[model samples]
Target: MSESAQAADPVAYIQHHLTNWSTSQPKSIADFNVLHLDVIIFSALLGGLLIFIAKKIGENLSLDNPSKLQSVAEMVVEFVNDQIKNVFPHPDKLIGPLALTVFVWVLAMNAMDLLPVDLLPSLWTGILGLFGADPSHVYLKVVPTTNLDTTLGLALCVFVLILAYNFKSKGPMGYLKMFLFHPFGKFFIPVNIVMTTIEELAKPLSLGLRLFGNLFAGELVFLLIALLTLGAGFSFGLFIWFPMQVLLDLAWLLFHLLVITLQAFIFMVLTIVYLGMADATADDH
Candidate 1:
């Protein structure tokens, strides 16, 4: 948006910043066919970068004199392992690595929000403009966690893992039996089925919505703060608004560092807890 237009319509400016660079405009809120190319691209890129860093760290392991990067990587791994041990005490080889991956990947994705809101989007707009695209039509949202599809996709994977762990620990018949008679006797089978199903489904819904809501609200706050100085030119208003903008932005950035890290840790811990529940046998219950 041009300076004059952005100043004139702060709503439009915020909306433009929030819009995703998608394959096509969504028809409705429930439309699942639309592809958010920006979310997919940024998510994949972050995941690939994480894998590369991990591989390099693994290759250059030094016991006597470890690099700072290696030291930090080891600390993260050890922290995740300790968390897994607390919840998933069993010697399941998969849970440790899975928890670590989820924590690091989600942390990386959330960290993207730390970038200046207009940085990537503006850069992408300029690149597209060089290729004859209209600047006004270009849309890009860098933070993948702000996208519901991305958050839900991560939750759905955890949901699938929950089911798989249940099946592995309790056989197919045992799994069915638990759903049919859980938290109630066989006499109340219908109620038990309904309650158990809802309980299972709520796991993913809560997981996905919690992460998405927090990050989406954070993104909106950043946009609103940016709007504070939208129209402030070399006038006296610039002197007043500019300092407030910088102060607010810096304060938020500091707090959001905790938010992003906490969200990632919550996601990881909850995944471990859910899997722990799934691994419980009938006797344990």
Candidate 2:
């Protein structure tokens, strides 16, 4: 969208904001070719930030007197450990790091929501302008979780872990038996297969869709609030609209902080639980 178009139509502005900075504009149904460059970039940067912080904390280990950062990091590690212990009886060494990474990386992605919607977009526009590109064509969405692909990708990783743990705990024959008999019995092998496949697919779908749905809705709400507040200046009843926008936006921001944290924690816990379930044996039950 051009500057004049955005200025002339708020709807167009919102549409532009919702679009991702894709490698190319999708044209046909087979255009699985679209890549959300913005989502991948932000996700990678946030993941790198988490790794860097973890490395720094490991290097500065202390017993006598820990810095505030170390104290906070310890609390996070302890919290994740506790969660794993509660949910996963046979957590491997990787589970701790995986849980921590998921929690922190997701929390970082969610934190991007707290940024002003226009701030990054405006800055990106300016940067593109410097590079002699049409600023309007440069779409950038800072929140990775808001993109379905990002959430689904994370869920798929968890799904793979679940499969691995299942195979490890239950041998190949045992794993095959799980799908063939356990849920229904040998007589209902076909039904069991169908049901088991659905169940397996549902895990990742729910994990991904739940996170994506919540964050996407939150993002949309924030965008609506931005439109409300920003559009107030041009609305007919400016006096009333402006004040209401401020109150609502502020209220929503406070409420959304809780939402962002809870969503990240929920995603992490679910991943842990799913893996735990995979690792469970009939004897344990």
Tell me, by lDDT, which candidate is best: 1
Model 1 spans with C-alpha error above 4 angstroms: 1-3, 281-285
Q: Which candidate is the best by TM-score?
A: 1
Instruction: Provide the global lDDT of candidate 1 against the true structure.
Output: 0.90
Off by over 4 Å in 2: 27-31, 231-239
lDDT of 2 by residue, 75-178 (tens): 99999999998888864899999999899999999999999888999899998899898967888899999988889989999999989988998988888998
Residue 30, model 2: Cα distance from true site in angstroms: 7.8
Q: Provide the global lDDT of candidate 2 against the true structure.
A: 0.88
Minimum summed lDDT over a 10-residue window in model 2 is located at: 227-236
lDDT of 1 by residue, 199-260 (tens): 99999998999999999999999999998887666988889899999999999999999999
Clashing pairs in 1: none
